[model samples]
Target chain A: MRYVLGLDGGGSKLLCVIADETGRMIGSSLAGPTNSSYNTPEEIELSITSVISEILANHNIARQDVSIVYGALPADGQLSISTITKNLHDGVKVNLCGEYVLSLFGAIQEDYGAVVQAGTGSFAHIRTPKTEITVGGWGPILGDEGSGYYIGKNALMACVRMADELGIFTILQERILTYCKQVKMRDLCTLIYATPSNKQSTLIASLCPIVGKAAAEGDKVAIDILEDAAEMLFMQASSVLKLPDVEARFPLTVAGGVWKTNPLLFNCFSTKIKQLFPQIDLRYPLFEPVIGGVLLGLRDLGFPVKAKIEELKHHFSAYSISADLFQ
Target chain B: MRYVLGLDGGGSKLLCVIADETGRMIGSSLAGPTNSSYNTPEEIELSITSVISEILANHNIARQDVSIVYGALPADGQLSISTITKNLHDGVKVNLCGEYVLSLFGAIQEDYGAVVQAGTGSFAHIRTPKTEITVGGWGPILGDEGSGYYIGKNALMACVRMADELGIFTILQERILTYCKQVKMRDLCTLIYATPSNKQSTLIASLCPIVGKAAAEGDKVAIDILEDAAEMLFMQASSVLKLPDVEARFPLTVAGGVWKTNPLLFNCFSTKIKQLFPQIDLRYPLFEPVIGGVLLGLRDLGFPVKAKIEELKHHFSAYSISADLFQ
Candidate 1:
């Protein structure tokens, strides 16, 4: 049987799955961060290849046996997808597809749909089954208007303010300061500016929940900051949602730590979304988005997926069922 | 004739003067930061040598004939008069005296008196024409409770707070962030924590007048921040004023940019000083503190400074003089 591969590259971790033409996911592997944001192109290639190679070896599948590979990865500068594809194709052979193509393909079982991604970066992509319309994912420099990084960044600013006035010091600043190992405000400022990566900032942002917790406890200041963050996110989401030809039931989903952990943020996002687009059908993703990769791989190889989705689900059902696997 | 060299080192700049044994000024130079808080010992030495070498060369003065080189520097970390003496003596021949000795020598002129130094770093020093006691000047970390760096640091923090959302966007953030070229709040937060040097912060703090202007235009938050900064300075001056042996009518002089530029701060400091030590005679320094260094150098050589002060003043009276040169 013809086989297909799906890869989901992330900043913190990478996931890959091998599925049959009939939609049965037969093998899988997990590894370190594959997002080019975390690793260089060469490093990303090595990481992606290692996971793909291991899964192929375990499943006794030769490179030629795989008909297609669909991968969704955060963009790394430009031609990042092609660079990754070239690396993957160097040893593991397959017809490699584009990043957004796979992410969109996974979201809709159809050959064409839209997916607004909000993970380490944020972007919106629309496909009429052939061409894709993409907007805004400039990685906090030019864009990323409202993402976890934005929320996390603003939360830090809040903590810094409170700390300066000896205003009710929250656990967020204490934890972030401890994590950063900066006792004085000056050292903290230096490290944040001098350090090359936004990685530590992301970690700092992961503490946005503390801001939420404070807001939940009726901190007017915290509430105001989070509300402002929500407003920025809403404005960006609206701009993407109203783009030309995005269908009424456009698949608008958030995939990031900020939205997942902060229920109030989710409520805020949902309320804003409803106010903007009443007909939008929002669905909690049924499978880890890597499954979108599997489905896209099947579609890319011209394989039927409706009946195969059942078999693919049954095969990965064991891994997905463990719930603790995510933990 | 023996030449006496006086060095006034503070947060912003170093002022050095060369005077004859009779306290008659010969040549002088102004250089960038000499406080150890600004650079490493090696850098400080290099900077000092560059200025000192220039002065000695310009005046055709032999290094060995310069009887004593006394400096009043921000006493922080490992910077002490003895440390400076060893550093200068490493390549040059001269007697090096402590920072406080230079201040006391500059202020009282008679080898006895107290001086409150509030520059990049702050401290109070008293000399009984014999024994000396100093309070504060613990750098920006342990002490410097009411120094310009302290006030400036607090002001930058207020800017960070206003940027995060009091729903009030003030000009302070724009100025600071533009200078720093930092867009993200996290970058601002990190830069604030990383203590670059008291000199760097002092430079940033030089922008406080801009913040004050913003306050005058009715930025309640900015006004409140300046008020708090003034109170801190008031307390710091009070801390120095309370030294046990420092008697009433002991000349209390305010030296430093903050004391000169910030009228509100000066008013608050003056009001508090009078309230706490009514009998303490306030002396508006007749010259810049670096001249006090010149006075110190002459006095150390056993010059009758009381009579020579008149001679030096008559010769250099037309020149904008630093009283600190004598003390």
Candidate 2:
């Protein structure tokens, strides 16, 4: 039977899956980060090859049986397709795209829709029948509005302002200090400034949960920050929808750790978007991006997607249940 | 003749002036930066000694003749008075204070009033006859509202947003790219991400003049940045003024390179403050901050400051004119 491989490479980790032409998952594995912007080409190649090799070896499947490969890598930089594909086994056709593209595909299960991914960083991808557009993926220094990094950085600034007596006191101040193991404001400065630039984003992004927890507990400052973040994210989506020739009533999906973990932020975003664009048809993604990659591989193999969509969905649901029972 | 030395040690440069107790300027010199936060205590000591030695040698003055020394070091961190004093020549009494303190003394030529300094960093110091309060000097990451660093960083963010198509195209975008010698949006990203954190602030602050130039040439994005910056600074001043027991009608002085160089920003700040507090007694400083150091030294020497203020101001003006003519 002909099989395919699917990969989702993000900043922190990589997920891979192998499936039959009918979209039945046969093997899966996880590996380290493969973000091209943060990692060298050799590192990315190693990450991709190691995961694939592990799955193939575990399942006792020969390389020739895997007809095609689909990879959705973190949209950190302009990744070269040849560099990634050249390392794969012979006769395996590779299709490479950004992680956000796979996220959109995973959400709508089609080539058309809008997806706003707000994890450590935030970006929006809008795809139509004729056009595709992206917004707000300029990283922390430039953009990343409404991202976890943005929220966390703002929280730190609020603490400083409070310490300087320019802002009223808030619980966030104590929470942030304790979180950073700092007793004084100057110590916090030392902590932040002393961290390396490459590691600073992750360190700051880690503070998002603190802000979210505070917001959930009704802290005014924290709530304001989340609300502002939601507003900025919604504006990103609104900007895409308002673009000329783009449909206003297409499917909209919110993905990523920030949205999945913080229901208050998600709800705030939903309400703001609805208030602005009443006609938008928001939908929850049917599967993870790795599954979307599987679907892309199936399509490349000339499989009839429309007829198998319902069957594949049912199969994955059952597969998940069986996997959980064994665990 | 017995002379008093006044030293203003900042992040970029050190300014020292020697004048007799009667406030007659005898010698002055400049040296490298000695910001305590960015430099080691040893480095600061070395900078201080270098400038003092240069001025003394140039004017043929002895260390024993400099009986009183007042140095205002930038309030980047907690400066040690003993460490600095121990290195100075014996019999020379030293009084040390924060840069903000001397800025206030220079602007009002007295111990009371408010001074908002907006240089590479921004801070406000308000001194009442009985109490003193400070606001918003938390460095670049936390606060620096209307500072050159603030403006420059905001300008960089604007360029990123514009490049991502999240913001409208502006002339400031091209100006920033050209200033950084970046050819594409990706190049800008690499440039910023590769810069070391310690050097990043200086690099970002260097972009301030480009923003100022763009604003002067009627760029909407640049103008808005300056306006927002001015409003933030005015808010800092307004916050301190509204503090309980703080006098509302004291002389207010705006100091630092940001206010000194950008007339448009200065006007915006002035208009905002006047609109909020019409009773404020705004005044131009009689001399530069190093001269404020001179006045402080004279105060420590039991000199009559009230009688010498006018004479010192006149002497410095004449001194500057003669130096320029001779050069």
Candidate 3:
């Protein structure tokens, strides 16, 4: 029985899975962050190795049986892949690319479609038969509109504005204060500015679920923020659709933590997209990007993918992965 | 002759002016930045000392002849005042406070009125006859709507969105890219994220003039950004006006670099305010905040302000000090 390995390495955590050539998932494991921008290359290599070792040990699979290793890594995580491949069992083929590309393949089961990845940051990617284009991946400073970081930062600004009497009062103001363990709004500056940049991004992104909770409870400020965020995201997709090579009817897939966790945001985003492009089909990815990696690996090896794709979809139906586990 | 000194210390530079008891202009000098948040306490003290020493030396005045020293320091420059006082000649009384407060006194010639300081940062202050209220001085990260920093940040974001084909194309895009010496639009992320935080704020705030130039040339994106900025500022003042203790028809003084330099932004903001509150009388400050510090010093010393106010206004008209000199 030939087997393959797939990994999804992000800024927050890493998910690894091993499956048979028929796409039956045999075992999986999780580990710490492998984003090379945030961690040393050695750290990332260690993390990838530990997760892979755990999977093999648990499933009683020989290292020689694994023929391919594919990873969907954060933009900065490209540095660690060579080290990971060399340390793994000899003769295993390794492929690594941006996490978004893997997510794109996973969502549509092919490279040609639109995918908006909205997690700690956000970016939209569209792959046509001949070419591909990306939008809004400039990180938090320049772009990342409709991202978790964007939403959380706006939520924080709204809270400050409310405290300064420049905005309407909302329960979100009190909730954010409590969430940060801050007694006075003025002290929020210390909380935000005093932290290191990476941790700061994470701290701000962590507020997304809180904002979503407030929106669910009918907080006007929270609703407005989410609505504005949804519009920004829809604009990203609309821009990608305008690319000369992009097909108008291709599936538009939404992925990442923001879409999965915030149903209100997703509903707003989907409704706006539907209103604008009624002909386009929208989809929630059938499986996580790790599973997409498996599909990508099989295709790279010139293996037939139709049967494996269907099998993976069937497997995902029975696999109940907790969202909290990844975060 | 008993002389008083008033200094306006900001992120960009320090302005020191010396005048006699009758508010007659004697001597003035400028020096590099003394903002304690950006510079070390030693650096700030040196900058302030150099400016004061230059004024005394050039004007042939003895240090002991100066009886009062009042400074309007930036939010972060509060540390340099004590060092400044301790280093000054004996028998001189030193007073220091937030730059916004001194701007309020300078613009209104009293301790009370509505004053909005919209330079690199923005904050609104309302001093009613019986009580005082402040709004939106939370700095660039949390609030600073309608500020130079806010306008510049929006312009950078507009450029990124334009590059990504997610926003309307505008002249500001070319101008910002050129201004930053970036050959490619994507390089802006490196330009923005690579700088130290203080220099980053200064660099971003520097884009304000480019945005203003684009707005003057009628770029739609620039116009929209300024219009949005204008609304945010108007809301700050409008909120302060709604305070119960605020007088119905007090002078609303507009001060700071944004209003001083960008006639288009000022026009938009003033027009919006006029449309919303016809009862409020609008005024441009007759003197800079350094002179406001003088007014504050005089007030603290129990000097009658009416004559001195008239005298200072007359002096400022003849002062011929270039705004660029301070910055």
- Clash count of each predicted structure: 40, 0, 0
Docking class of 3: medium
lDDT of 2 at A166: 71
Give the CAPRI rating of model 2. Answer: acceptable
Reference-based lDDT, residue B204, model 3:
82
In candidate 2, how many Å is residue B257 off?
Answer: 1.2
Off by over 4 Å in 3: A1-3, A20-66, A74-78, A299-327, B12-14, B20-63, B74-81, B298-305, B308-327
Task: Give lDDT: candidate 3, residue B159.
Answer: 86
Poorly placed runs, candidate 1 (over 4 Å):
A10-14, A30-42, A72-145, A169-198, A209-225, A242-247, A279-283, A287-289, A304-327, B1-52, B55-76, B79-87, B90-327
Q: Between 2 and 3, whose lDDT is larger?
A: 3
Question: Candidate 2 lDDT, tens digit per residue, B114-201?
Answer: 8888888888888887788888877776678888889888988888777766677779878788878888877887787688666777
Summarize candidate 2's per-residue lDDT along A109-132 as a digit string, tens digits: 778888988888998888887788
TM-score of 1: 0.55
Better of 1 and 3 by lDDT: 3
lDDT of 1 by residue, A134-247 (tens): 555544432454566666666665564453442355556665677668895556755664554436545645656666776778766667666776665665566556656677
**Each candidate's TM vs. the true structure?**
0.55, 0.83, 0.88
lDDT of 2 at B322: 23
Clashing pairs in 2: none
